[model samples]
Target: MTQPSRRSSQADPAPSPAKLARVRTVAQDAMRGARWWTLLDLERILRADTEFWRDLWAPSLAIAAHKVGLRNARSRLDEAIDAGFHQTDLFEPELSAAFGADPDWQRVIERARANVPVPALRLTAWPEPGPAAPLRLDRAEAHRVPQLLPRLPRPGEGAWETAKTLLGWTAGLWRHANARINAGDALDVLEQVANGARYSCVEYSIVLAQGLNALRVPARRVWLRRGDYHDGIGQGHAVAEAWIDDLDQWVLLDGQHGAYWADEHGKPLSLPELQARGHPARPVHVGARELMKDPALWAAYFAHASVSGIAWEPKGFVPVFQDGQVLATERLVRDSADAYPRLSDLAIGVTAIGGAPAVELKPVHPYAVAGSWNGETITVQGRQRFARVLDREPGEHRAALAAVTPYGPLASRELRWTAS
Candidate 1:
């Protein structure tokens, strides 16, 4: 007993160099991404409620649905949902549908819908779009975006996935031909392509852009030119870009190649972003067969030497042949306001229910509606369509709805009402 009592307290071992290095790298990455400055951000930081923690842990939460066979796939997905990877739409359609009825999966979707975070909103109000020019939203008959939308294959969820699916469908419309024939509008182009007319990249972009517009996603054709475009030797290439409300950024879609570009994090990169980064892009192909066989060939096509000038066509329906009607020059636009002047020109309908404190919100354009009522944040993503009914306590209710545009949320005109 005397010998045992002589033992001294033990000290903990120091962390190994490898462990210290990994920790430093992770911390550095987190700090670089936080970029917090505002007073609200400070409070969130103090409360440890910033999305930084969620963002940091997102990669580890990624579920490889492909690794598991069809038999075990459902259980694996259930496990993933229980672990907090709520992005079920990211999964393959077959995989998700095969086991969507599971209680855990259904619960996760319900929870995600209930806890939808508020989008960034403008304080102006609904329908009173500011000084910006209005977006020429496609008439249902004008582009046939409605008819074509359901016909198109939407394998995954979200705006980005739909754009990629449309790109693939557009690229497969016809074989590539250098012929300069007029493809007319997107519908006309489809009709002609079906009748054995091979078109160029211009037709591909035209169809892709129009297809996205039908889905309430703003998009435009991008005309890429070589530095010596004036020589008229090599006019340039044509591609498309769509404004994804989910990512809140313009993502390049090459319908001609059935591909799109992304950064290290799999975030789709706009054409200008690719140019700024010396076109170090990772191409994501959507089609069963790639338009460009060699992956390395894509970088060369988008290189500064190959594509020096970038121009965008005006929104709405424009004859593919009349593309040159709009001026073409060297311009690198990343700002959503500049890229899409009419983004805020959204069509919204607010209707009151008889003698009730509730109002029905109908947004013509697709995407969710986020806003506040008496300082309480609310975001509504309807299943039937982009419409929702909001109810508040009986009193004078001051509510504002924000349209979630690719350029960010713009506030709508404030609605004032008294409920008894």
Candidate 2:
């Protein structure tokens, strides 16, 4: 294979007057729709916050015309992330917290410097469902993914908040179902839920993914193995990861604990990447964070990690997200194959020759679909691969794709189409 010559992320060319107007429009709409647009604490933070420029950032003022998004409207405030302003923790403003003896909350900046960084994926399309391929919406019996977004019980902005909202909304519902029995279709499980039946990790994962789909965010269930007999978390662990368009990366989220994984650098990570970081105290230090106000759920994450399972997906066979939820927490994949196969690098990557997208997915499954879009409109949809169009679409054609296994939709990846 030839070596990739292009940089992961490059300096963005100056936007034309028209494009600049579009940026202004995007910034405007974001402000109009933002939930954290105004708050008593935010007013104080922005006024006193020198984090960004002289401006309050734009979150409440404009994202603080900087954080990522608005989450939980009340005493329940998750850090509202202002995307463009502080794309990474590296750009975080000054922290007044006492250092050393006191927690240097500001250390987030130093840690970011020590971590290996990847280029933010470029996007040409709007971050929504049309750009990303549709999951098993047909399986929902009565409601499709879009149809349920308004009703999914989560209107929060942070990826972390959205995940827990789904889990809590379904509290006391999922009992247990055999993995293989319905390993492929999460929509069906969703369909059955109306009848007041129980669900498993698969159902939870499916709903989580579909809910993301409803919000127009690219998402999929990520599967992990608890290999090495860690804690016997069964065969593996499964969780949903959502692609945050502004950040240009996928954020791993678990509905059960309302948790997410983060590197020492403060960048959100996918489950595969998260599991890859566990080294028993090596060069890399990985950790998980919870959405709850209380820190109780944090320790549970490590205990949950002790379960026995594969660190990654097994060779030749791609595990579905449904079974992962149970295995990741319980430490065992239900009815897992007796022999543990070697781990495969199933990380998704794209291969572009000219200025076009060539998306390739690993552990290929039959029911899954991959697609690309020019903005929000569909440009091409593929059953197997990108045997479709030119990543050469005019302007920006964002890269997005998805697949629904017999069990449910696997995780989806969203990236910018840099080829054009």
Candidate 3:
């Protein structure tokens, strides 16, 4: 993908908020969170071409809702039709049947999901994950990934193939990069490791997701933060999860462990459900331990799920944002295990880093950054000093970043910076 022509080196001076406000029109557009059909994005589409919106927009939403099994979706479509808002030519038959023609709603939804391209434009990264992550699966990779598919079983028969594939992904063709995460495009990092270079767990999670998406399988990276308490494992880790639309849920598939969570029925478990499980202390596979470079030799991590921090549908390595908060559709984030308070200073923004204004983390995450957030998202990790340009205005603005750390809630120091 072409990097936006707008360029900024690590050494460039942090543009003042005044200058940034002038460019907000551009930066904010690029920073939009996933494929969310926000007002601004809608305006862009409407301005780009109305017929595009008129023909594709409502129909796409209907298709998307049906795909995700969103409740009352077909009803909404029928409502649209009743109001003459939706053209009949644009109405999908399966969708129409789901509401009226077909008596079996479940069957209708399944059929719609099976036949349609995943309708991601209206979905968010969480609650219902979308397809537009920055780390992309382009046409080339999508076509190239099928060769790797058979190595893991198709996600059936209790996901045996899913287990093998997850293990294979974590164990195969990847070297752990000892450096900081590149922090932007998942594809860019995968390119580095395509010929067998090193990447972090975050990168591995993304690559696995990309491969699945290339095959037209829906998936997203799962952020697994080691809560304040642990078996002495690392602070955070990432893994990939696949969307079983038929099941209407996401299930964990950890490449690093060649493992996944399952219910008593031995079915795959979604991140939220897994977090809510009564997981006890468990053992981490030796290979998994090696991959993570954890200190506890017997693999204390596997014994039980870390409950303190489970930001289901969290943002990607290159974070996404809308409004002034992180990109999660669910505002209330809690891991059933840890009852400690959550932190509000959990975000970082494109502020000055060490007296230099830079979006990409230099000498750390080594990739050009794209995407914007007002202030709602995880701050750049790694032990770096960074700040965010405040809301463009003429007065003082209070900034807050919230995150859940192992020790408890993490709060950024109360910062009141004047915006003038």
Candidate 4:
């Protein structure tokens, strides 16, 4: 037998300075028994705090630099364990915490070592299923569009009529073929709408979904990762899914791409095939750089293009009202500078008003006067506005004020009305 060539050994590659720093920080944190390693803890930390990232930034940059040279980040991480610079437990602290106290980790490692060969790939050989059953649109649903349009004068100016008018307008927009056409050509047409400041990717997706739902077309917001469409490395995409009843299957439509359910040959493609062609088996991490750039693109991707249904920021921050009372107010502050000016002023007013025990106020707006009661003091944004209680008696007290904004009345009923 030929003698084996002498193997040349080089010193193990040194970790990048950044990588070493990260490892040191993580190691230090782990030593301290901090809960920061847990996913739930991480999420909580991200939501309630922002400064944590500042602390981790240096380490993250270092880790990223080390990972840059590695063919596969995961593999490189594993190699670090083999080289004795790092332990597997360092990477998966959650698992270590779960099983380190017992022999579970060893048992798991042993079980994994005896792994059998994976089964061979098998094609789905079944024939296409029959077409789906016909779905009937109800009168209420069918007439939903017609009702949405501005109607002629009606008998009563009832709230139901107003709601019906609004619904009718919405329905008309959905039922209109042009609206459908606009959605069909969303890739091109939507940009114009965005330019007009009338629509966004999220709004467009919602409009499409709502339109379909109004027409009795079952549509859902599907989330998935698009591997190819990336502004930068490892940034995936998202989209929507609609259930086509006549086709007896779910259809993938790219509201952003303006592509219908058909392929190049105009043949309808199944959900699986569509996903295989566009979406990937694994999701790429959506980095801050991608989000900070054109958030609308990502928003559109998540709202209309995703296959996993885990889209980000689906709802616009609209306040919630329950039984003529404001339950909660939500506002989406895009830029801090824009938000601070308005919010700071409101905060000051609230502080000043709430500082007082009680005071009387006169009507400033017509809507305000209608709702004013004898003694009502309204608390808004931490500020208090008092209204006189006009009909205050031993057994009864009522305060009224005009409607404030669209949510509810302005004044509170508890304050004594001091008429001038």
Candidate 5:
């Protein structure tokens, strides 16, 4: 491996008019997009490439602007730091220098420094045996899927877009009412809904999950409750999540309200992500319909979002709970850092050139995954959990892994590293 050379910013001359405009344009877009990393990188670029050290510190400038009471200058920097920003970023020297002087900025930094990072697998040893069987659930009957095909979007429509369309359709099925019917599954709910039956949030989740499963998109019902659930707080919300093959992550869908929460970049969020309290999710509705237009109102619902469990059926294996509830609480979590796995949990490592130059893939969670490393395909499922090694050259390499989900194969999670 070779090291790239570096140039000193002090030796660079002043920027021309064109370069100034380019820098400003980048700064403007970074702020408008609410992508915190881009704004940070812009600060580094300005400090490294030209004499304008703090000129492009857009977020920092906004924070300072807020303190000065500038007209229409409400700094979302604090909110950005509170949500979506990582603790690893709190230590950036440029960031420290930019906001270190202000006492108010220092408090925000301190709070963000305490934020939890997204959980990823860090294997200390090779994977052991998983459950005797993968968690299987009752899928929408194939014969009944044809009934839903005509109502869905085109076959090749994007995963996220298709999901949103289905959410809209399911939500508009019937008016929400707190009535319990002796329905067996989502299909039963749908049939009853057509005959003038109004159901609760539970039915909304079931129908959405079934709808997605019918379309070959991996989906499951999730129950959210407060910590005082057992004490009869009577606060809970049922929603469904679908594994988007393009994003490689599960996104929450609320058919009850015809709503889903997304970040500023329009990326749909999972229940766990919303529980992380990192990013302020914006409420989005399907089609031209408007719902939950207020951010505060949306955040209030998810503020106490404690997941009770996932809704799935175990084929050969008997679950602790018979109500088809697979606990997502502390009972199921191995790591205290995160409540649950947001994406497919995987452990990947590479051997040195002297050690035969290979990459080892380990799928940790019980969910089945199909992966490819350096032109090799690997599949892990059920008790068949074992490290699969792929031969690769002693250079930069990349791998793509996706869960062979209940809905189908989701988007692949990409991994890249240099093998020396």
Candidate 6:
């Protein structure tokens, strides 16, 4: 496939001297006594034209900031003043002076200060949720495969058997439970497996690797910070890619979810479908130390626990922000497993609770809830408030609710009336 055009790196004209002075001040404060420049701090100082900063100065600044050893340094706004970097407007005079003296840097700063492009507003209808398949991969099969996880195959042996094994495991689970096999059900099973276990994406990947190994499949963990389509933020995601003999190319699999790889319509997805969206794809290999230093990666990876099938690429890989400072440099991972659980599990539960009775519900997290039921409807609040009743009996009521204003439905539960 043809690569997308790279964003332009041409610098715009410098901002007014006064504005430049202000920017310099912020940069000085950000850089004073600090070892390096943080993408977040730079972003805050140059928030006016993020696109220009991202496209033109961001790359250079990212390198420079890291070189300066400011990635983990605390903000030095106060120290900038002590160091004569800050001016009357609490701006960095040194940075201003640097810009005035260095034509090249001046040009970059100018471009970085340019106006941002207003995104075009377009209205697209949200697609309807697809049907939920039963939990595939029975407990016994799940236990068996993990124990029998095959060794990493030889380079030329291919990953088809591994893929088939995963598929068979999931199919067995679904069939045993008499449940339909769909994307959502697959996620539920994975979530149960995770069970609040705190493991790095790599760790999770390792677990999956073990399972795949037991099944004699060659698999590797892929990781990266993915950009969001709706919001221009970067978060981490994980996926397993296995070599497939049939396709003769490595196919991406949601190891966190079940084996059946389907889109919203339940149609199977190819490798391309499982890749990242928007940005050029890069392989992710993170060590334990790096993962610990970057906790946002974990949060980012898990944020999409409720999304549908995978998108081809990340929306973008902007710097991660925390308390107005760029805490982490983010890149969009093409294959993310983190989004699977959130999107698939809660979505299916909400669908099951559709139109159920209202009850006295108390939500634990914005994503989960518990409540007492009444004779009519079951009421619950989580990501959103929901009520439903089964068709067979009035006492059989269910509700799904979200604590916070969610993009869609949240927690779901069903309860039947008991003799009082």
lDDT, candidate 3, equals 0.41
Tell me, by lDDT, which candidate is best: 5
lDDT of 2 by residue, 1-420 (tens): 122232111223455567545544554464455533332223433333333323223323322222323232211111323222333333233121112222543453344343433333454532232211212221232345455655567555644444445545543345445443265344555557667667556566666676665554556665544333233445444556665544434565655444555566766665445544543211111213223443332323322232122222234323233333333332333222221211111234455534445554442332333332322322234443433344454455545454332223334545455432
After superposition, candidate 5 runs with Cα above 4 Å error: 1-156, 226-234, 278-280, 293-298, 303-339, 342-420
On a 0 to 1 TM-score scale, where does candidate 2 land against the true structure?
A: 0.33
Scored by lDDT, model 2 comes in at 0.40
Query: Candidate 6's residue-wise lDDT over 371-396, tens digit each?
Result: 32322333444443433332343233
The number of the candidate with the highest TM-score is 5
Taking all chains together, each candidate's TM-score versus the true structure is: 0.47, 0.33, 0.33, 0.23, 0.47, 0.23
- Residue 327 lDDT in model 5? 38
Model 4 compared with the native: what TM-score?
0.23
**Residue 163 lDDT in model 5?**
84
Answer with 1 or 2, whichever has the higher lDDT.
1
lDDT value, residue 162 of candidate 5: 70
Could you give candidate 3's per-residue lDDT for residues 1-420 as a string of tens digits?
Answer: 222232111222445566544444442353243232332223323223333333444444455445545555455344334333434444546445445555675554454344443322221111111222122212225445555554333543322343345446555656566554566444555556665667666666765665555434445665554433223336456677664433434556665554565566666666656545455223233233334333343123332232212332222221232223243332223333121221121223344445543332121111112112334443453443333333445555554332322212222333344434
Overall lDDT per candidate, in order of appearance? 0.52, 0.40, 0.41, 0.32, 0.56, 0.36
TM-score of 6: 0.23
lDDT of 1 by residue, 1-420 (tens): 011122111212444567545544544453445321221122212223223223222222122222222234344344434445455454446444555666576665675444444332222234533342233432235546656666556635666677777887777777789875573667767777778988888888777877777665777777665433344444467787876756656678888888898889988887767766754578888876676666555554453211213333333222222234434334534333444433333445554334322444443334345443334444554432234444454555566554554333544546554444
- Residue 342 of model 6: what lDDT? 24
Tell me how far candidate 6 lies from the true structure as C-alpha RMSD in angstroms: 29.2
Which sections of candidate 2 miss by over 4 Å? 1-143, 157-164, 167-191, 228-233, 264-267, 279-420
Order of all candidates by TM-score, from best down to worst? 5, 1, 2, 3, 6, 4
